[model samples]
Target: MKATILLFASARETVGAPSLTVELDENSTVGGLRSALARACPALIPLLPFLRIAIDSEYARNDQQIIPHDAELAVIPPVSGGSSLEIPAPP
Candidate 1:
């Protein structure tokens, strides 16, 4: 089965691409995809644990099965805070 993986943030930087096409088994799970990704992109190995796999816009679990044809897969990296909250002055 062929599937497309969308990479984001650090994941994209690591793989040096916004997306990639991979061949996986019909019954491949999220964990299986991670392993295959690690094999294909060694740079992603260390970051895999911190990344989340989303299938069709929903976050998928490790054991969740992936349907290649109907799935829209994405590798979401850990997110960090941007700015500090400000306190408003009493009028």
Candidate 2:
């Protein structure tokens, strides 16, 4: 089975594409997908660890989560943007 995973943000930038396709076993699970992706695209290995995978528009709760055939898959980029706190320096 092959999965065309949608990419976003840094993941998209790294792959130079909005999506990537990888071959997987018939009973591929979320964890298996990760492994296959890494093997298919080594450049994504660094970001793969932090990126969240959504199956059928829902986030996979755990690595063991199963992925059914023809299911929608996406590599959700890590979130950014939080106001930094500033502390006053004492004289």
Candidate 3:
């Protein structure tokens, strides 16, 4: 099965690409795909826990099975909400 993985923000910089198309097993799990990515790019392992995955625009669990020939593998990192709180600058 062929799938396209869309990377965002840090994930894109970590993998050095905005997107990647790869072949995966028809019954591959999200976790499995993550592991495969780690194997391919060791730099991503540390950020795996911080990353979120969505399939077909819906958030998916790590163990969620990937559907073959589908178009919604997007990697989303935690997004920041605007806040008025300010931190003190180093003196």
In model 1, state the lDDT of residue 64: 94
Worst 10 residues of 3 by lDDT: 82-91
Q: Predict model 3's lDDT versus the native.
A: 0.77
Reference-based TM-score, model 1: 0.84
lDDT per residue as tens, model 2, 1-91: 7789998877888888999999988877888888987998898787766778899888885555555687889987656545222212333
How far in Å is the alpha carbon of 34 misplaced in model 2?
A: 0.6
> lDDT values of the candidates?
0.83, 0.77, 0.77
Residue-level lDDT of model 1, residues 1-91, one tens digit each, is: 8788999888888788999778788899999899889988998877777789999999999999997567799997866566222222333
Clashing pairs in model 3? none
Which prediction has the highest TM-score against the true structure?
Answer: 1
Scored by Cα lDDT, where does model 2 land?
0.77
* Residues 43-86, model 3: lDDT tens digits: 87777777788898888899889875565798877665563223
After superposition, the stretches of candidate 2 with alpha carbons farther than 4 Å from their true spots are 81-91
TM-score per candidate, chains pooled: 0.84, 0.81, 0.79
